[model samples]
Every structure is written in C-alpha cells, then in structure tokens.
Target: MECIKCKKEIPDESVFCMYCGKKQAPAVHGVKKRGNGQGTVYKMPSGTWAAEITLGYYMQDGKRKRKKSRKYGFRTKKEAVEYIATLKQSPKKEKFITMFQLWELFQTKKETLSKSKRTAYNIAWKKIHAEIEYRQIDELTVPELQAITDKYGTSYYTKRDIKNLLSHLYQIAIRDDYTDKNRAQFIQLPELQSQEREVMTKQEIELLWNDYQKEPSAITAQMLTMLYTGIRPGELLTIKVENINLDEQYMIGGIKTTKGKNRKIIIPDKIKPLLSWLMETGKKGLIAYYPSDVEFYDAWKQKRSQLNIRDVITPYCCRHTYITRLTTLKVSPAMLQELAGHEDYDTTLEYTHLSIAERLQEVNRLD
Candidate 1:
C-alpha cells in the first residue's frame, strides 16, 4: 500500500503512514458520476462509495488549479451516503503548533510572574530554547526533556529552574488547547540531595575572627557582619551605610537584589562597636564595606587557607550561625521568619542547627 498524502510505500496492513502519520484510504471498490461535471466517486475498499471532489479555480497569479479531496471514510456504502449528506461536519486536521509558539505564549504571560520567577524562566529558556524552538509541540517527548536536564548537569540549580519553566510551559499549552497532552509531564528531575548546611563552630568562628582582625580587609568586615546578622552574604554586600542605624542597632535593607522582602536585623552587642566604627569611617554607601560579594568571598577563602582552618567555612556559615544562636535563644518562628526575610518558614528552618552541647543542655532541661 502507498500513503495517499506522501505517496510513500507502506506495509499492506499499516493503518497509518510511518512517515506522515496519515491514515491511508482504502482501495476503490466501485466508481460513480455526479452532476455539473464534478469528479468521479469511487467505492472505497472498505465498501463505501463516496464522491472524491475536484474543485477547479484560478490562482491569484492567474494560473488554473485543480484540487482533489475526499470527504469521509466509512465501513459500509450506506454509511458513506449518510456521511456525504453531512459532509461539512467532518473534523479537520488540527493545526500543527510549534514549541516556539508555546514559548511565545509563556513569555506573553510572564509579566504575571514574580521578578525572581521571571529571571528563572528566562534563564531556563536561554539554556534549551534554541534546541527545541522549531519542534512541534507534540514532538517534545519525555526523553528530550531528560536529555536537556542531563546536558545541563546537576550543579548551579539550572536543572531545577528549567524543570519549573518547562512545567509552566506545559501548563500554559494545555490551558490554551495548543496541546491535548504534555509529554513533559512524565519527565523526571535528577534526584538532587539537599545541600549540606554549612555551619561554623565557635572555635572556627573565633579563629576566623582573629584572622580578620589581623588582616582587617573588607572581607573581615563582611564576615563579622554575616556572623553578627543572619543576612545572606549576597544581601550583606548590598547593605548601605544609610541602611544601618547604629543608635537603633539594626540594619534595614532589601534582600538579594530585591528578590527578598525588605527586612531588618538587630545588630549583636558583640559587633555593635565594630559597626559603629564602620559607620563613622565608612564610605557614603555600602555598610558592609565590600566592593563586591565575590571579592569578599575570595578574600575570606584565602584567609581561611592561611589560618589552616581545614573546615573552610563559607560566609554563609555566619548566616547559619546566627540562625543557630537564635534557635538556641528560643526565638519565635514568626519572628525568625521575618528576621530571615523568608516568605516560607521552611526556608528559615533550614538555617536552624543546634550544636551537640546545646542539644545536651536541652535534654538535661527536659529532665
């Protein structure tokens, strides 16, 4: 048998063409003639004789054109007659929409997303959009999504972000009827183990602090601020002198390029004198006194190596230390959430790590 659409030879029993997915028309069993010099009607191999209409028209360029088309397929001649009576009611092939169209639809609705979510969406698009942009929406199989995930690798949180963006794309496609089904629904994410929370010991903090005092670089001030306040190192880098009120002992600023809700942190008495000194001698902006977060982190790493502190605590450890101490002090969950600028309590909870000594103290108190 040959497919009518593509004229490709197919196996005798094949219902759909392998190349084009077109349903093959059964062989003609008989022929008939219609009035007004229309095309001949043939009895389909399925025992149905239907009119194969040929319409003639002049093209826009003045060329004559003849188009032959079939109306319906039926198992019986009577069914064919009935189908011909309502020929206009037959369903048409759905338009083929591409992944790029769906992406455009997603982009159109991106304004409704949060700024961070928008950034995440764009980042994901940047990674794999080019590879699949021209593909039909129905062609985006689970394996393709998996391949993208594998290609991007596990580090840098890009896979997670891409998954989220793809999920949203699928959702939008379904809602808009662009696709009857989402192939990406079955796509699996690489099972990423949660990052081990970096924590700083009291001795380690003291050693780092001592090293900072000796070196007194911008990293030293940044590290001290991170330990004193539980703010993220990225947030620490954005803190301005105007954001800090030394008399009130709190640093008020927006978090992480304004991704987080605006929040304030109470300065610890231990770091109050240091903050006051910075405030007095500090430049017009940036209270933490670092040129950049990268600079601060790199300098801190160098100092850690110099001090030979094998644990190698990151600046983030100070944020964890603050949360740990706050947990020990029995701060309320709501307050802690607000202090950490976490919209969700679960995120704030991840920072809470109780030391063995503190755990033992709590156990003794239980008695």
Candidate 2:
C-alpha cells in the first residue's frame, strides 16, 4: 500500500504509513471462527472468501507472527471503512507548554540580571503572574498584556516594567526555540510626567520647626533628616541606625535612589541636634522611624487642620525647603548638585523654586 499524499510505501495490513504517518485504506474482509475457537479473518475483494490464513497473522522469516489488529474487530464492513477514513482526516495534536514552565524559564534568566533589574522584573512578574498562572504559554495574547497596561493606567513606568518582563520571557522562549518571535517587541509605553519639586517657604519652614519644638518626637527627627539631607521620605523611612555616622555627621548607607541606585548623603547642621538625640537614645539596630509616606501624609493633613494652616505642606516640602534655603544662601549649582546627589544640574535647579515676590522683584529690576 502507498500513502495518498506522500506516496510512501506501507504494509497492506497497516492502518498508518511508518514514513508519512498517513492512514491506509481499510481491508474489505469478514471475520470467521476457527475450529480451535479463535477468530480468523482475511481481506477479500467485494465478497466473502474461504481462507486458511487469519487476518492477524503475517508471514515473516518463514514464521507466522500473530498480532491483535484493531481494524479486524469492526462488526460491520461499513463501520471499519468509516473508522479508517476518519483516522486519515484527523489532524495531529500539537504539544502545549504551560505557564509554570515559562515562569521557570523566567526565573532562571532573571538570576543573571542586576539587583535593580531583578526588582523590576519581580514586580512585573507578580502583576502578570496573578492573571496567567493557570494558562498555557500559547494562550497568552497581546490583548491580555494590553489589558494589564490599561488596568495600571497612566503610570508608564509600571507598564514599561511589565513589558520588560514579557520581553525577557519571550527572549528565553526564543533562545530555547519554543517561540520564533517576541510578541512584546512593539509595545509602546505612555509618557510620564516628571515629579515637580515643591519647595516650602521660609515662613512654612519656621512654622514646621516651631511646631516640631512643641512635639519634639520621632516625627521631628524624620522631618529634620528630610530638611537637612534632601532625601526622599521613602529612602528616609528605610534608614537604619548603623547607616548613620554621628562622628562624621553623615548618613553613610542604606539610602537608595528612586532609580534603585544606592548612595550616601551628608547631614547638615540643622539636623545635627536631632541626629545626636536619636543616637543618644541608644536605639541599637533599626532607626527610630515612624509610619511610611502614606501614613505620614495622613498625619501631616491632620496636623495642618489642627494648626489652621491654609498652605499645602507635605513631608517632601522639607526637601523643597532645604533646596530653597540652599539657593537663598547662594550655594553654587555644582555644590547643590553634589549635595542632592542629582545627576543633572537642571534637576537641582527645579528644586530651587523662587517665591512670587522674588520673581516680581527680579522682573521689576529688568523694567
């Protein structure tokens, strides 16, 4: 027998060809009962036939090899023909890789990434993995990834992180020959607004410092650190006691930038007394810290309400206050850049917001 499509040679009794895997034509035969009670069958063209050879036996090496053939078991000749025709038309099932397998690949590749990269990858993985953990790799579509970006909204940084994770996963798949192309290659991230630095006024600073004197607690120390060092509230909250150097008057370690880079900052004179008090209190390992940024913001709101202060003041306002004070003291832009650990001088300048009166005075001078 020969395969219809590939014309590969196959045994007359065989249902599928060994070379092309194509199903062969069914045998036109009927079953017969042997004297020994075993069933004997033979392929006969168009009619019934008397035969000594059983359909199951094939002569090989001058020996009769008896095999249990399923094609011979069909009750009717029509059913046997239909079964063979169905087998010929059926498509082969393709293997599907699970999401768990893809995640394992993601983890192995993520180990080679930098600390910052690993953090971003982990964050993105957590977000996507929540939805697709039970889905197959082939089941993941572009629309599902786009939905994730839509859910996160205009925070393009998070969307970029998610896209980056997908890109890495696709790269792993390509390297392993699991996929021919990366689907996430063409995803566009939305433009994010740069955070505007809001500097507090001298009067606002005086009000906060005076209010701190009245309370003189851990919050006061936290506020002082922000004002003196120009460190972000998130960075300050994570500060440990060991990271500070009272003798050198500096925060030596445990301060991470928004971009996830680590750096040291010099503590100014304004926070010197506050740092001294915190150190003298003998808190061994962890710094005496209060709540997080969100918590602090809530407390700040309540404090504002109590003080009857109409101005908007945030914990970050301390950083603004410090930058404004530096500009007022006529500190060089280079020195400000160094103190703020800013890569760009323009970023340091943004922190130096001049008052409306000062702006008017400069304009009047030009007139």
TM-scores of the candidates are 0.51, 0.55
* Cα deviation of 358, candidate 1, in Å: 5.1
lDDT of 1: 0.69
lDDT of each: 0.69, 0.64
Off by over 4 Å in 2: 1-95, 104-126, 201-220, 232-240, 253-264, 277-320, 342-347, 363-367
**Please, what are the lDDT tens digits per residue for candidate 1 over residues 1-367?**
8888999899997889999999887554557656653445567665546655442222234443443446655565555555553433323213344566678888778989755567667767877876666666666678878888668645547777877777777787778665777666676766677776777777777886786567665566667778877878767666788778888888876555342646777787888877776666666576555443445666778877877765547777888888887788899998887777777889888888877888898899873
Count clashing pairs, candidate 2. Answer: 0
Candidate number achieving the greatest lDDT relative to the actual structure:
1
1-367 per-residue lDDT for model 2 (tens digits): 7787688776677878888777777754455444552334444554533223222223346554543323444555455544544433323211233454677767776788654567666767777775655454555677776786567534788898888777777777667665677777767777777775566655656766787778765665666678888887766666677778877877854344452246667887767887777666634454544433445566667766666655456777777778778887879988887787777888778778788887787689874
